[model samples]
Target: MNILGILRDGTGKMAVGASVAAFVAATCLAALPARADDVTWTMATHAGGHWLEHGAQGFADKVALYTEGRVKINVAQPGALGSPLTTTQTVKDGIAEAATTWGGHVQGIDKTGAIVGGWPGGLRPEEWFFWVYEDGGLDLIKQWRMEKFGVVSIPCDTGETEIFLHSHKPVRTIEDFKGLRVRTSGAWAEIAAKLGASTVVIPGDEAFSALERGVVDALEWAGPGQNFKSAFHTIAKYIITPGVHYASGLTECIINKDAWDKLSEHDKVMVEVAGRLNLYESYARYGELDIAGWAKLKEAAASGNNEFIKLDDSFIAAAQKASNDWADEQAGNNEWFKKVLESQRATLDKLETWDEFRLPIGGVRE
Candidate 1:
């Protein structure tokens, strides 16, 4: 069925007659993958609510379109297939074909997971694009996951800068954090402790009650949009600024190795392409949602219910030092963590050269 070889050796013109054309079509059809490469996958996810649900659905839609319906992904909510913490494990164990997961949820299994999720003073969401697509980080993540965890990993979704904290007590300075009780998650709790804050983890379902009942003085969950969804603004008196804990965050889509192996090469690439498209698209759209949420938060501020508090700029340097020290400790603890850390920092250094030369656009952001 080597049609090209037969045509190359034919003693005739390159133009195909009707019989040859029909024969070539038949050969191509026969050469294709079995079932015409049609595949359907359940995309189990750790995220059930907020913009992430939309983002996951968008990824599924894109996969179908990019593969021309040869592949289909049906996204499932958290606990639909398994619990949030079990998402990656489900994919790894082949109990699920794929999952979109927050790496922060798996830090116990791999400390590097938290780094991938997001850490204080790390690369922003835009910076992640350079590191992943241009700086070979994608290949490294893929190789590491396949070798160590038996899954295909793609940097699939990103969230923008989050709220620093919703505080009952105003955090106007670094000192204000001293003895401040906060309910938070991920790497931020470690940094918060260094800032003299008492950090606690409360169940997400009870976070509102915790904040309302003075169980925790402050809470930091996500950006404005998600925070609004959780109604933190309704109770906390102070909305802190500059989410240094996580300037942004990354989440991955993982596929079972055996399930991925069943895909044709073209469809595999299409999935990756769909992931890349959704990564950028989801981040931007989420930011827009945050902007609208911020507007509503502003109205609440104007009504004398809550105050918008910007911590002194000096807190930035203190946070940066603490975050870097914690990151170094992580790098020293694991090889994969060390590699990704070096790659991200090195890429940021290179980008910093151009960033320093560019003129500011002259907004508050400058």
Candidate 2:
């Protein structure tokens, strides 16, 4: 028998085959087929930035390191695999193994899922993580995912909730909000309207162009992490800090039911562990990354071309009050909404107390 042919046919040919032929065959097998340990999974996200890249790619790196390179992940950014609108279905259909997408875009398929993931002024990262991991919010999010979206929702980072207002004109207070056309999405759009601002709901990719063309006077994207990539620094001369209107926002890593089912018990556990770890890291990193973005803002301001505004207590209180009222109204419209609100509030009370105690410098009211 030809040595090469024999090597190809036998499972244990490393002993009998010549070293060179065995190496060639091994290379061929490695490239052509996957062993039980050699698994490659693809994950998709809507936004492209160093922050997201690190959070996601960092997770993959840790997974490979932990699993000894047995499991690998390929990260796809910005509709590379599919639109956020279809990412849930894309993953469910096995078009992609996993995805990290904004909840609002998928609200049509699962409104409850979006609310639980992150509604405007929703669960803060610290509180949300405690509620999910220590309390019971994770199970609740998962239940809604299975029941409504037929996917697996892993609550990842709450990326800094610094909902900045980047606008052509300075917005010092609520009075400046009148007749201002702002670009927004999800429940926040309603908040904008109630504040007496006209809102244009456009795909995020089109936001910068719209802002540049003077289509919208104000734009409210999350933090400097995402805003920098959009280059809002160049066009929008003013940025308002401390997003009181939306206390929390969620960026979730979701997996197809079928794909999740294929993960072995141990592998599934690894994914869950890595997800939670990265989620924690993301919260910490948000401050660091946003600070870097702030440096850029400062540079622009120093040049006498732009300005950054810090929202006062009154502004934040007003935004939060409006948001709370909306949440209450939503609950009135849907019984399930009330249940979620109660679950979150109940969980928040416990987490906030524990967090305050843990930090010690902060006071806790119990």
Candidate 3:
């Protein structure tokens, strides 16, 4: 009745889905272990709501099917293990076997981690996939994690939602940013700061309350898709964008190095297969639903529930220039910053055609 035996009895064999052969090569170094019974682990996220309900559940389901239930992961959304910041530590210290963590959310430990999620004008999904999966970006991130945190990361899922300003009052131009307190994160906050807004890093949960209490006059949360999910639309009437940012937010399904090592070859393969499938599925799913979300936003705007605002050409130019300059400044001191930016840019160049075709895949083709 040991866990491994239960796992093996539960999931008799490991099977790959349609895509595993294309991405990973089987190796004797990490061979399948003798089945004992069962293997169970916990997966944690910051938002245990719809995002994980649909997105992370896709990973959980595949693990169950691919491993035949031998390897079962109980999915926890909404900081079940702890805050997003603590999830990094939880996985590393084996407090939780696996977790969904974002780089920006853990600046207390590694300030650079947030850069993977979104940058001012960073890579889109196609370029991001090529850079991380094909162009050694994933390897580099793994090395960085090992060097700094002792956690092993798998690219779980990623999708871009437009970064826009939701404000109590209409903010139509750069001038409107002046003296306003706005909620933002990482480089976007710096971009807002450069444009004259004072930026605060509030947890996503507090954003609405901050706006309601006038703690922040505006906020650039995710696109209409997530804003609706988070219910920010109920508080803020103006949703403005110069298409200023997009979050190809990476959620790492990281496992403790030791626990990862203990996984049976069969279980390990199942994890990898599940990770890849989850990434593709979540990315594709977000791309699909977000289009409808935008349409819903437009309909709401028409009905006077919300106002969709766009940045003028001049404001976009100024914001882009400011963001680029800020990135350059950070690059001089942050080697990883330079490395990721260059890798992303180079990959974007190579996938110029893929980007062209992939645009419609995720309707955030700005």
- TM-score for each candidate, following the candidate numbering: 0.84, 0.80, 0.84
Ranking by lDDT: 1, 3, 2
For candidate 3, the per-residue lDDT at 126 reads 50
* Residue 100 lDDT (model 1): 86
The digit string of per-residue lDDT tens for model 2 on 1-366 reads: 122232233464322224423443454334433336567889877666643576667677655654446678888876788775566777777888877766676655534544665666677666666566656677777787677678898765666775558889877677877899998877777777898889988767778899999999988876776777678978888887777655666777888887777666555655665565567667777767777877877787899988878867776677778877887887786665677777888876666567555655336768
Q: Which candidate number has the best lDDT?
A: 1
lDDT of 3 by residue, 112-216 (tens): 665666676676665566677668788777787877889887777776656578888777667876887888876677677889989998767678889988898
Candidate 1 per-residue lDDT over residues 1-366, each given as its tens digit: 322232221465332333433443344435544346688889877765553465678778877875678888888766778676668889988777888877667776777777778888677878887787778788878887776678899887888888999988988777889999999777777788988999996445456899999999998878888888788988888999888888888888899998888888656766776676677777777877888889989999999999998878888779889989988998897999899889888988988777678865336852
Select the stronger candidate by lDDT from 1 and 2: 1
lDDT of each: 0.77, 0.69, 0.70
Worst 10 residues of 3 by lDDT: 1-10
Q: Which pairs in model 2 have colliding backbones?
A: 132-138
Total clashes in model 2, counting residue pairs 3 or more apart in sequence or in different chains: 1
- RMSD (Å) per prediction: 8.6, 11.4, 6.4
Q: Please give the distance, in angstroms, between residue 4's alpha carbon in candidate 2 and its true position after superposition.
A: 50
